[model samples]
Target: MKNHFLWITFLLILSLNACKSIQEKANDQFLSGQYQYAINSYSQILEEDPDNPEANLAIAESYRLSNRIEKAGPYYEKLAEEDPSFETLYRLGLSLKAQEKPEEAKAAFEKAKGFTQEEEYLAETQRQIEAINLAKGIDNYFPNHVLVNYKDLNTPGADYAPVTSENFIYFTSGRQASGLYPADGTPYTKLFRTRAEGIRVDVGSIQSLPEFQNEEGLNQAAIAISPDGNTIIYARGNSTSPKDIPETALFASYFRGAGFTQPIWMPVNEDETWWNSTPAFSPDGSELYFASNRPGGYGGIDLYKATKLANGDFGNAVNLGPNVNTPGNEMFPRPAADGKFFFSSDGHPGYGKLDLFVAENDASGKQVIKNLGENFNSPNDDFGIFFTEYPKTGFISSNREGGVGDDDIYFFEDKTPKPKIVNVLLNVYTKQRVAGEPDAVLEQARVVLYDSANKQTGGDFSNTNGRVRFTLKPDADFTIIASKSGYFSKSIPYTTVGKTPRPEDLVQEVTNITLDTTIVLDQLILEKSIVLENIYYDLDKADIRPDAAKELDKLVQILKDNPSIRIELSSHTDDRSSDQYNQDLSQRRAQSAVDYIVSQGIDPSRLVAKGYGESQLIIKNAQTEEEHQVNRRTEFKVIEIRE
Candidate 1:
């Protein structure tokens, strides 16, 4: 009997030895990233011992990495059921999430909280729970307008990080083919630009910027442009050697004509070892926000802000801390018009893939990070986010299937809820409530303003029947300048102390603005008629100059935003031409003004164009020959007020 017992013990020892060997081999395979092989090895050990937690967990991890998540779920569930721990619960939660059982996943994550004493891990679980809840509520965001399927506008690649300046929209695309052959003979990612016409991407034209291309690198990804379009910043890396330098740096350049000049790398002030990328600038150009994976960071990567020093150098960088960053990888930091920092992260518990999140500094300057939710995120990598300043149409990059390639850019109409009333109406003349007028003159009458720094702050034009309004920005400051020929020029310095007044309170608020009647100052005027010293036309053509168009568009917006005011469009010419000929030429020019406004959706009845010819010449004909040039002009006056 003693000998028989010895034999059984000996057999058990042999079995134990064999199981250890299998577990060791499985672990090695997993570390080497041979997921399928590891799964097979782990299964062999589990066959010998069905309740072996280590072996079961190994199999689950391998299956998870292989994206056979369904197969992973049962194995992880068994391991958790046998011996619940933080690691086991985490794996179980992740597996259930992959299987689309969100409620089960949440329960697993909550169970994980009880298995760990680490505050960091506990906070992380709470964050994940919040992310899941926020994602569940995403369908609630209903935007003002949605442009779902427009042909030219919707490209195939993952396109995002849009920066608009003047008439151009610059963005990054992983779908565009790079001319150079990658190591595997594949096209790398690239950056492309198009016009912002708000249509079927009827992009007047499309062309890749030479400056943004990385001849033999991973590909330039995130990009940001300055307000005036003069400067740009982008992120660049070498994909072939991602770990050689795990992160990317920011580069800046000046726009020289059609191309950008040589780009200059922007490095961290004191630390050159770490990497910096995804640069976003404040509207006033005073502050810069970027992503970095430098040492001392809260986690994988964190958002950092650098203020411009008085000496024209960037200040030392400041990490956003626990509020904005997580233990998971957080990259692609972009600051929106509302001063909120938008970024992408994989560490937070999310629906899937990397999710987009926004971090903002509250009144006390404390940071608050909020997951943007499923509206902007998918079950795939969602990065390179950007939105328009005035109208919230923007784009995001993703590889979430249903796309053209591994990645495709999706232009999304921002469905974020906005304030009840967006802008306030304005009466620029005499600050009185002037309403109702013919369509033509009313359409042409508008106001626009520029700051000393040449930035457009507020103002929009009117529609038909003489009315106008304005979309007041947060704390916008500008010098309001009004223009309409036959009347005098007007200017007003305006400033808003706090956030824009809510839409509900705006109607009852009396925001008054007065405009001067255009006066043909005899001594101030040069010759036969007052000339448009600021209005410039392109060479040998009647088409207004590009700069002139920008100026006029601002005026058009002023009229469109406000309503109910009338004006007379008039044109004058130098005394050199016969009265009859000058009169005819002036009238045609006046009509041109009428046409542009009408094309912009303004009413035709509000405006009336008339040629005064040399009759209203501001300067005497006897002045120097050069003086006569000033007499040729175009003007507008508030001739009639409807209400």
Candidate 2:
């Protein structure tokens, strides 16, 4: 019986040794950065020993190193519940934040602060708290644009970062999941292309690059084409051996006739350990912007800029500074026209994970960053934006739910309506009288503008169409003087007191309010009789009646307006009156009219009154009452000129 017990104990010892051996093997894979293999091995160990710390921790960290930090949330929750530690709780916060549980994440971070007295650690924890609060404030804002998933281009593997050039669309995708990357268990990304119109990509036209440009077991992604469309720069590199540190570098290619030339390693990559990717060119193609994890940055994966040298090589790299870079990773630098640029970041205040942001110069000319709002971003890995049109239309990438793949491409267009504006303008049509009608438009006539203060604001000549325009201020009064050579000058008053539209009425981006008027000017020619209508006198009286005085007032003002000339005021008689009596009465009537003008503050030297007795009439052979009435009329002409 004792011998039998020893045999059973020997079997138990062997099984225990075998379990230890399997666990050590998985540990080696974890330490060596073989996260995918470690995850698999840890999963096997977890089946038998669900409470094992080493196996659970390896699986969680493996997910993190593979850029799948979201997958670690469940594991971290279990581990923290079992035995909470500073590392476990802090990482738990990150996992919860990635899953869009901000309140829970904040609590985890608050607990983590007590585990350490390090200032940097405490400061980081506070930043997380502050970021969560800031994001809450941003949640109230509507999305600047609406994003549409690329249902046609996305696959089960990762696909992202699409750029446009000419008639083609360029992007990267990982379709082959068989040769899984050790760190991620996903196939390495490769450059892909398809026909496109604007932001729309054709599904059936998708094609991969030649084998040379798409090397096996390597990642070729994050392509940026120059504005000229002749050059393209992309990131292409990954470590095959565990002994070598994983590296990504910028590669360039030039287009010739039909296809792009073989990509050459760029010189800007100074070191293999720099870990550069996601390159973009300035709109002018004079500078290159990209993301890197090199030393001397604000923190993890800060953005950098390098000027294109005269020899076509890039100058030394320079960090984008603190306002843009932060403690967390910042990737995908996309520059737009003007001084604005787009990028993605986790360090900035965002909804969750990495959110796209734009850097713009504010009114004070200082750079400020803004979130893209809730629509284009979510609680997932959102990054890699390429703007097809500035601030409006663009391509984006996200790993949010409802996408076809892990990281899918999307197109966005700004749907926010533009602000309303109301512009008030006055258009004037200047013309002169011809015969009895005002049909002759006076081209080249000078139109002078005056403000409410009576100061000359501006002056301009009428166009060939006899049209002149002036911008009018809301609720203001003004006068315009229209004058031309050999023409009588006149002033017209205009007001825009109630012409403005209410704020609510201006619903369009631009609202135009145009007011128009016409002016008629008479030519100042000597001996050009200017008949004055609506004047009358009693039957045969030589005295000027009250009605006659009213007609004379217009002449009084005309003489006042044209002060440089002397006017002849004349009175005529109808043929019905006897010649001798008409002659005698006409002279008296003319003298009476002139006497009235002299009484109204006019210089006597400027008056020249004449009488025509049945000699000057508007109508001859006056038999009817209407004809006789037309025959008896008053007239004046510029008989004398002082100019």
TM-score of each: 0.49, 0.68
lDDT of 2 by residue, 177-264 (tens): 3366677777888888888887877889788854235777777899988889878899987657655445889989887788788988
The lDDT for every candidate, in the order shown, is: 0.62, 0.82
The candidate that achieves the highest TM-score relative to the unseen native structure: 2
Candidate 1: C-alpha lDDT: 0.62
- Backbone clashes per model, in order? 58, 0
Estimate the Cα RMSD of every predicted model relative to the unseen true structure.
23.0, 12.0
Largest lDDT belongs to which candidate?
Answer: 2
lDDT of 1 by residue, 334-410 (tens): 77666677788866656675677777787899877666666666676677665664336766666565665555566
